[model samples]
Target: MNKKQETKYELILNAAFEQMKEKGFEKASISQIVKRAGVAQGTFYLYFDSKGAIVPAIAERILEEQLGLIKSEVKENDSIDRIIDVLIEQTFKLTDRNKEVIKFCYSGIAYYDSFQRWEDIYRPYYLWLEKKLEKAITTKEIAQRKSISHQAIFIIGLIEQSAENYFLTDEPKKDEELNLYKQDLYHFIKRAIS
Candidate 1:
């Protein structure tokens, strides 16, 4: 599609999100999205099968965007701890601003029977972590674990678990406390692995 088409599709998706937030996901209407987007109702159908498609699409976009930050932050020669710290800090910061997006992720799974597989949407982070784990082992910085793949997966899963909490609960951490938590987590992971 052309740039104009892509822009309109994005606008429709953005409007759908606002409507979903204001009205709960199940109750958010297609007309509301179209009206808010200033798009003809027909235009929305041309882009998304339903508002459900937009939920996963938005999630996929977020993962892709954040993974780019990870790529730029991690240098080839950086220590495993530094790489992990970069991932942790950038992820926590990203999640702070995009709580609604993360909420929509879990809500997508709950509400949309047909939402895309999260693995497919989030493949880049998985692949990057896998590569880092491989390097850490070769450098002897990472101790042998029960399948490094599983460990790396678990680490990412832990962050996602944090994301869910960060979305749904009121964190008592002031900024300083949160920084300490990040440092503690980094040290814990580094010691646990290396």
Candidate 2:
């Protein structure tokens, strides 16, 4: 798309994101989005079919943004421990950057009955993690007691849970506390594999 079209699309999506955060996905409406965006109502339909369609777009954009960051950090030649650190660090970094979007995914959005759409955005990144686990298993960088796919799910779930815990708190604990939690988590995971 041309620059103008790209800009319009971004404007609409960003407005939608803000509305969704304030009113939630189920309550957020197209009219509100276009109004906030200062774009015509017709312009919304020019891009998205419905709020449900926008949901996937938000999820896809979120995943792509963070996955791009993560892809840069992981070393193809790095050991499993190093990769784990990279993965956890990238996960937390992205969580801090897009906490709203992350909360939306696990919040009322997940109950939308469009499970496939939610899964679509996550599948690519989850598959990438699975591939990494598979490679580590094959290279003996990590243990092979379980299937790499299962291990990937474990890693993804752990990251999500940890991040949710971190973001859900109000006081915002210190960096040292978070680091110690991560270290403990890593050792627990290592024990399972070792």
Candidate 3:
């Protein structure tokens, strides 16, 4: 697509994201998204078949943004422990910031056509984490003889689930308590792998 098309595409996605956050995935209307994007309703159909079609784009965009932020913060020579710390911090920070969108994405996986495309949407992010874990093994930082894929999944799941529990679940936690939990979690994973 050209510059104008790309700009309008971004606008529509941004509008959809904002609308989903404000009104929720189920309630956010396509017309409002188009209107907020300043694009004709037909233009939305030109890019996306339905509101659900945009859900995967939202999920993909969130993952890519988080991955970029994490990559920028981590260096090639950083210790494995530092890498893990950065991953946990970045994942938690982004997940907390986008709780609404993340929740919507999960709902999309459950209810929309996104379930069939889950692997396609998330494989790159998962592979990136797997490679990071593989690097730790090669550097002799990770002593355990475990599958990098499993390790990556475990680490990512722990961080994401912890963030969800703190931000999206009904359980209440104070700032101090949350920080303590993060420290405990960081240490637990570090000891388990390294």
Tens digit per residue, CA lDDT, model 3, 104-158: 8888767776676876766777798887777888888888565877777788778
Model 2 lDDT vs. the true structure?
Answer: 0.78
**Which of 1 and 3 is ahead in TM-score?**
3
Which one is best on lDDT?
A: 3
Overall lDDT per candidate, in order of appearance: 0.78, 0.78, 0.85
Location of the lowest summed lDDT over 10 successive residues in candidate 2: 105-114
lDDT per residue for candidate 2 within 67-179, as digits (tens), equals 88888888787777777777788778778877776666555355555677777777888899888777778888777765776777788778767876886668769878888
Identify the leading candidate in terms of TM-score.
3
Q: What is the TM-score of each candidate against the true structure?
A: 0.85, 0.82, 0.92
